[model samples]
Target: MPPDSDSPLPTDAELQILRVLWSRGPSTVRDVLEALDGDQGYTTVLKHLQIMFDKGLATRDESGRAHVYAPATGEADTQRRLVEDLRDRAFGGSPETLVMRAISSEDVTEEELSKIRALLEEADGEKDDASSA
Candidate 1:
């Protein structure tokens, strides 16, 4: 399903589950538990899965003894929505402001800078093509 523009982002617990589902596809509660931090309990994992299902963030297949839960939203869509939300809330909805924050905030190593420069170059190329067209 498409990420709801105004829909709230997943809670940290939900995000943790989603990262697993996103990377591994539909997963059982057991699978999620194994992948998650050892500090969390088995019941805690099941409880979070149930809550996520109720919240429309997940779907379960009950054909098997152990149900498999999958994310309803695409990972990219969710990430975009979240980054956009942060951009709006923390950076006044400006990509430049968001980039500035990322650049100025903690230790941005040369590797990160190189990647950012490449992305900027690609964006510039896209803009030039659009304008020229």
Candidate 2:
């Protein structure tokens, strides 16, 4: 049976395809295969696209032999959903804990912290606007 409408988050392979579609726009299996530098063959990419379509994570145009595929959702939407799922599953739904853990990582740079602060300020402004509405 095909996947349900509320299917689980994309697998790593599917996320790779989504990243390609997001970066390059709609593309065919061959396009994605060429873009990805992994050992996965053409058929593997084809199967991944098909599965993504079934799972409602991707859409395809079959008017031509080489069907063009694109992500059903935007990059931010997918990222938000993935992060929410991770927060729930691994962080006990505590976003503060998640953010603290993430920021504590050595890979996070000062520039990234500044960006995060800016985003938090923006979010606070939005919340204030919504409350006054």
Candidate 3:
């Protein structure tokens, strides 16, 4: 199921579990716990999955003996939501400021910079096309 737009964002622990689910596809609580290297206990991971299901961050398949869980939203969708939330709360809703801060804070690779430049050019092209229309 797709996540509800109104659903609360995943907490840090929940995000970790979601990443595992995203990478491994649907899995049981044991599977998730093992994938996490048992950093968190079985019950802890199970509880997180239960809460995630309630929050629309995950879906559970209870048809089988061990309930299999999967992420409710795609990775890209989750990332976009996270970035948008950060932009609104920390950057005064300015994506440029967010991007600038992120680039300055990290040692971005040259290839990454080239990708960013290409995206910017594509955005500019779209803007010009819109204006021409």
Candidate 4:
């Protein structure tokens, strides 16, 4: 499904599993576990998925022995909610401040810098049009 820019965001763990589901689509616990980067066990991934289902973060298709789990929410919605939450908690509810902080954050890479530049250029063009109108 396409990301919904306005949906509720999942928690960090929920986001992690959701990312896996979003990328792979309706994965079983074993599938998710194997995809995880660390030494996470199958049971552990299954446990997390169970918690996610209970939290209404995901849903399962029980057509077979291995249940296929997928996100019950939209990806874009999740990302928007997460970014907004971080803006409130970490940047005092200012997206401008959050963007500033993120750009200045140690984890930012050259690709991210290019993305920010592109977004800024897009915004600038929109503003120019609005002013001319």
Clashes of each: 0, 0, 0, 0
Which regions of candidate 1 fall more than 4 Å away from where they truly are? none
For residue 102, model 2's alpha carbon misses the true position, in angstroms, by 0.7
Per-model CA lDDT versus the true structure: 0.87, 0.90, 0.92, 0.81
Which number leads on TM-score? Answer: 3
Candidate 4 clashes between residue pairs 3 or more apart in a chain or in different chains:
none
Q: Model 2, range 1-133, lDDT digits (tens) per residue?
A: 3233367789998998899999999999989998997658999999999989988899989999879998888898899889998999999999999999999999999999999999999999999999999
Ten-residue stretch with the least lDDT total in model 2: 1-10
Candidate 4 clash figure, as a count: 0
Per-residue lDDT tens digits for candidate 4, residues 31-77, read 89878876577787888888787767788889998899998877876
Task: Score residue 114 of candidate 3 by CA lDDT.
Answer: 90
Candidate 4 Cα lDDT to native: 0.81
lDDT of 2 at 112: 100
How many angstroms is residue 104 displaced in model 4 relative to the true structure, after the best TM-score fit? Answer: 2.3
Query: By the TM-score metric, which is better: model 3 or model 4?
Result: 3
Candidate rank order under TM-score = 3, 2, 1, 4
| Cα error, candidate 2, residue 35 (Å) | 0.5
lDDT of model number 2 = 0.90
